[model samples]
Target: NITTDTLTIAGAGLISTAMSGDTLTISTTATADQNLWATFNADTGTTTANTTTDTLTVSGGTGISTSITGDILTITTPALLNVVEDGTPVLGGNLDVGASSLVKSTNVILSFSSGGEAAVNWTDISTALTGSGPIIRSVGADTNVDLVLDTKGTGDIDVSTNKIVNVVNPTANQDAATKNYVDTTTATTAQGTLADTALQNIVEDGSPQLGAQLDVAGNGLGDGTNLLLDFVEDASAVNHIEIENEATGSGPIIRAVGADTNIDLKLTPKGTGAISVADATNYETNVTADDDIPNKKFCDDTYAPLHDTINAQTGTTYTLVLTDDGKLVTMNNASANTLTIPTDASVAFPIGTRIDVMMIGVGVTTVTGDTGVTGCARLAEQGILIGRR
Candidate 1:
């Protein structure tokens, strides 16, 4: 049996009792005036008439039951002193992050509140603290404990200061153009480069000329010296250096300007001579002017046929020499002019020479063929005569 506001001893001992605010004063004798009650050996006391309103108090306690789900550390069994904080919790003593690991669950947030609402909520630092952070052991401790350098996603962890500071960004990702090299953007590939064409770029202070963009000529990145235009290949490799007109056709001639124009483009060879044309006489070490073409072949360059489109009235005789590649000769009779030809011996045209006679004049402009030559004179009016003579 249990009772409140009274005390009873198991052994034959005197009991004393007094009522206070929320404390019951009981003595070993029934004298009714004892402030402090101390339990002695072999003395078991009980209060009868028990109800749920009865209270039991313990003075000092340790190793009480505790549970932790996330940051809310709850005490299941009451401790000797239970402190609850409805407002801001003021730490009266130093908080020791004990030797145990301060582990945090995934995505667990540590929120800072002001005026009952969270002003700033820090997202998951579990990986940042545990993963990247280091561990240090004390002088005599068994294991190590991690000292987290709160590595938020915004900045890098400052190793020197052992804290998370802003990352020192490379020249890229900066809005200004003050950097010499951008570490962010990648270099551009050639845009449909010709097999023989070389690439070029312009630069200043080791940076690209046009920031991160390529020019119209598809020349980007560092200076043109970054890549040289040296043509190199094996014997069968027919490498050509061509000047482009645009993306589609040929452009202006690429010429050596200023004082450099006088220097000859001397091709150093392996077995024979300097520069060869059509496998003919190979030139020696130096050319004619040491720069100019040394007696080029009698064949013409890649140019159109050179002849008079008008009639030949001033000259008494006409002469033509047949080249390896053929030529197109146009003879238009001018007004009132009769074109004459010399004898077959004086005019000496090759046997396979092709003659084109086109009469475009309204007047009767007569043309005399080679005198003393056994050939038929076939002339057409308002037409072109094409035959091999």
Candidate 2:
């Protein structure tokens, strides 16, 4: 049995009455003013009714509650003094809203309108704030973002203060010769090199006089001296030695009067005595009695058989009186002209005729046999006839 506050039943011209039971029941007949309420401990109270229609009002307190029986209920929450539309509100440690679904605010739901059709729709929250017009970004500050005008493929990247460095357009018929590099700061212009006939003609000299001193001298960097010729000998080694001809008859005569044109041999004695054709010369001698046997060898130490044969035509004779390597002396009588001896006189001469042509210190003295004849000969001992015929 709960007791409520007093009912202020004010009826005009009718008696308000209640049924006698454990629960009080009041009835309003017509145009009757009856209020059933409960007073709380601090002017905060609850009004509950057994019927479905419950009207409750509160003023100047923290909160109020009421119970009614309809599915459609109108809840009036106070307009918050400090309102943040989509802010989270906490009651101690629990969330005051959205225990079931994510609660979106009216601004969020209005922006979620897809073009124009609007129910409460969910949309993606952009992290950017909008201005009145279109959004813009700077090319330098925008990382990983590409502008629409960028080229399609990858190209070489370089730093450029001027225009972009590209493969300089190949000139007309451009090749390595036609392409050139220039330094613009110095204002130097480089004309491209080309291989043309005219270009070659500008510098080419086909037959150059090489080894000209102008070509090899004086371009710096090394030592240069022109030391070029000077090496061997020739035919005119001696001046006047005529050994070419003998038949000219102008050659020197042997042991005769006007034949002393060259050197002659006349024997002289070592001891002072008559040293003619007779001397004990420790050698052999030969004599022949003939009127034409011109005063030739009378006695000689060379002991040659042909010592008496000084009249041989163009032949050499020798008398081995002394060897040049031993204690030997030699005397030579040479003929210049070719001797014309008869052939029978050469056949009468013997091989071992003991007539001398050389001696150790003396010369020839006498002649014995006939003078021989020959064409060309060598003297094995030491006398002389004609040199050669």
Candidate 3:
């Protein structure tokens, strides 16, 4: 039993007390669970074990100072941020490293490595390739292959041999000859007995045809027909030039386009008021009573044989006189001798026509038995021009 007025507990914080006369017993087994103090009075209840053990632990609460066991909290500075595992961590978490930090499962395949030391910085291609060892290539040819180079550090580049290609350069060679070409070895050379003799004779006679021999048909020469006469436009066709002789009141009309119904182009009438047209029905005809134009006389007989119009001569002196003022005469001497024609010597010949005077005298000294020397002149009175010896 204990007797006291008041009881207080400090340090260990345990107390038991009773009123001045009331009995108080000290019991170690029973105690209050708080920081408390008790007072006893004469008439009040007895007090025992009023002060108790400190049971307000404050382990986890809003306003409390808590500490962890085995943790060195010696008022250290704040820590830097640490990368968390799968879960995100705030700024002040400890940097804890577990046993197998970065793990790839046994059954899983990893294409690339992770968590290695950073490579050294380098610029040269040889340095980079050497450092990264052999890299694994896709092993097959891919059309859209990409070349990825390390932009940051040294690394190797792996390429497939299938990606290589060959570059070809163009060259030229001689090919087959074309159609118009005459291959030198295969082209034919022409030769004939009679033809060669004829060609030699022509050359000796100073008359080699060569390529200049005119093609009678192709060149429209010596084809036995005049090319102009064959392609003559019909006089009756529109705009075709038509020749008409319309004399003013005369003979069975020379020729005309009827009386005068649009006779724009009319030929001047000839003398005698006559128009001897080949056909009277084909041409509209007329006549002029007194026309002054001369009527050209054309012989119906074919041109005279050139030999008949020519006469050979041996004498030296010859005189020529023009019968008509407008008549023309040509004397050609191919005898290789000087020819002198004695005109009045005062009569000046009109221009435009030629008066060819040649020398066909005895060849200075005549060569005996020369057939060509028995001279004769050649001429064409009308059309058949001839050369005579």
Off by more than 4 A, model 1: 1-79, 83-86, 102-228, 233-389
**Residue-wise lDDT of candidate 1 within 1-389, one digit each (tens)?**
34556554233355445566656654453322222234332333434312454443433337666656666666655535444433556788987878854445543333222346543322233234555643231221224433345667788755585543344435555433322223323334442233222223434234323324435596443234423233333555444332223234653443322233353443478877556554334443333463546435322321222332433323222334333113433334444434344454666666655545455554343455556744333334565544454
lDDT of 2 by residue, 64-167 (tens): 44444575444445665674664554467865556564435432212233333443333333223375422223223234544232454886444475543334
lDDT of 3 by residue, 1-389 (tens): 25756564332223333334554554222233323333112123322443364232325344434555564432333445554543534457765767744333432222332224453222211111344543333222344444344644665454555442232322334433432222222222332223333334443565454434344675432234322222224555443232333346743222223334564655457776854555433222322244522223221111222223223334433333342222222333323322233333444344432222223332331112122334434323222222211
Each candidate's lDDT (Cα)? 0.41, 0.34, 0.34
User: What TM-score would candidate 3 get against the native?
Assistant: 0.16
Clashes of each: 12, 18, 10
TM-score of each: 0.22, 0.13, 0.16
Worst 10 residues of 2 by lDDT: 320-329
Identify the runs in model 2 with alpha carbons over 4 angstroms from their true place.
Answer: 1-36, 39-60, 63-78, 85-99, 103-389
Stretches of candidate 3 above 4 Å error? Answer: 1-75, 81-311, 323-348, 358-389
Error of 1 at 87 (Å): 4.0
RMSD of 1: 21.2
Considering TM-score, where higher is better, how would the candidates rank from best to worst? 1, 3, 2
Best by TM-score: 1
